[model samples]
Target: MTIKVLVADDHAAVRAGIVLILDGAADLEVVGEAADGEQAVAMARELRPDVVVMDIRMPRLDGISATRELAGVTDVLILTTFDIDEYVFGALRAGAAGFLLKNTDADGLVGAVRLVARGDGMISPGVTRKLISAFAAQPAREPSTRDLSVLTAREQEVLACIARGLSNAEIAGELDMAEATTKTHVSRVLGKLGLKSRVQAAIFYSESG
Candidate 1:
């Protein structure tokens, strides 16, 4: 099936470039383009694209707030120039499925959009480690540490692998299980933790550790 996408960036060139890249992909379609966050949200609601490629510093609503509003209704992939963007944590917490740098290669960008469109989370490897470490440094509550007790031993192991930025295939290889089984464990972990995506699972594991 063709994955419909909405590209939102303040720069016309950036939007054009991304649309061009996506248009080249046989399975991806650019359904709409927005110059700012508000228009992105409005177009998203109207177009209901499978994914939204968003920039954080857009005018009016901002991508973080827009992601919060669109959370659960559609997936969001944050494509921006900032690797350690100040708004990165907020966007993830607001329900973005992935965070990517604008400098990412064409294949990487296309792959990330496809991954997020299917409800998987993707974060730049360096940014993932940095984000986890930064969030882990914050003061966490006592009860938050105990939340891991709810997970089974294998589930805890899966969570740790996710916190380390291991994909399902990697986690499966590490645990000597099939990739599909690893995915099941991941889904269970998220459901048990009341989390939305692997990004949240990673954050929770980091803070709880």
Candidate 2:
């Protein structure tokens, strides 16, 4: 199935480049483009694309706020030049499905869009360590109040792999299970934890420690 996408960035040149890259892929199509956060949200609601490739800083709403508005409406993939902890954490907290740096190659960009479209998640490899560290520095939650005992052993293992930023295929390989099974475990883990995405699952795992 062709994955429809909406590209949103204030820079016309950068937005064009992303559109070009995404349109080059056989399974991906650029349905629309937005020049600012407000426009992004408006276009997103109208077009209802599978994914929205968003920039963090825009004139009106900012990507985080737009992301917050679009939550449950469509998945958002934040592609921006900024890799600061504030943007990273803010984007994830705003319900972005993926966060990637603008420096990402064409293939990486396409892969991130596809991943988010399919309900998986991605974070730029360069910022993954920083993201983990930021999460770790947050105050730990009380173990008794925030129990993970509800997850099965396999589900807990899946959550751990997610916290380590492993893809479903990687988690499957690590656990000696099929990729489909890994996806199942991931879904179960998120459902049991009452989390929205793998990003949140990772945060929960980090704060649990």
Candidate 3:
């Protein structure tokens, strides 16, 4: 299936570059381009693309807010040059399905888009460790016992793996399970916690810790 995508960035060059790369992929099509976040949100609402490749620092709205607006409507894959912890945390909490650095290679970018389009999640491997460290200093909020109680022991282990920024393959290897089984556990955890994406599941686990 061709995954329709919208490219949003403040820089024309960056947008063009991303569009060029995505256009080369047979299964990924560039549906629109936005110079700023407000335009991104509006165009996304209109186009209803399968995914949006977003930049965090735009003129009017910023990608974090734009992602929030597009939540439940279209998946957002955040692609920004900045890897600051705050931006990472903000985008994840705002419901982005994937976070990638602008410097990512063409194959990685395409793979990430496909991942989110297929109802999965990813964070650039380069920043995954940094994400964990940032969460370490964050204060835990009061957790919903009723929500967390629904998880089985193995599902709870899977939640911790996600909170540690491990992907399904990594979690599967670490926990001695099949990758498909791990994905199931991740989905179950999200459903039970009432979270929309794996990023939120990670944040929820960290905040509840």
Best by TM-score: 2
User: What does the lDDT read for residue 63 in candidate 3?
Assistant: 96
Candidate models: Cα lDDT each:
0.87, 0.89, 0.88
Compose the digit string of candidate 2's lDDT tens values, residues 1-209. 99999999999999999999999999999999999999999999999999999999999899999999997788899999999888988898888889999999999999999898866898888788897676567676665425689988788889999988788888989999998888888878877887767898887887687
Question: What does the lDDT come to for candidate 2?
Answer: 0.89
Candidate 3 TM-score over all chains jointly: 0.78
Clashing pairs in 1: none
For candidate 1, the per-residue lDDT at 189 reads 95
Tens digit per residue, CA lDDT, model 1, 130-169 = 8758866778765466778899999999999998878888
* lDDT measured at residue 171 in model 3 versus the true structure, 0 to 100: 91
Worst 10 residues of 1 by lDDT: 136-145
Instruction: For model 3, name the residue pairs that clash.
Output: none
Q: What TM-score, computed on C-alpha atoms, does each candidate reach?
A: 0.78, 0.82, 0.78
Candidate 2 lDDT for residue 39:
99
Backbone clash count, each prediction separately: 0, 0, 0
Which residue segments of model 3 deviate by more than 4 Å? 138-144, 149-192, 206-209
Candidate with maximal lDDT: 2
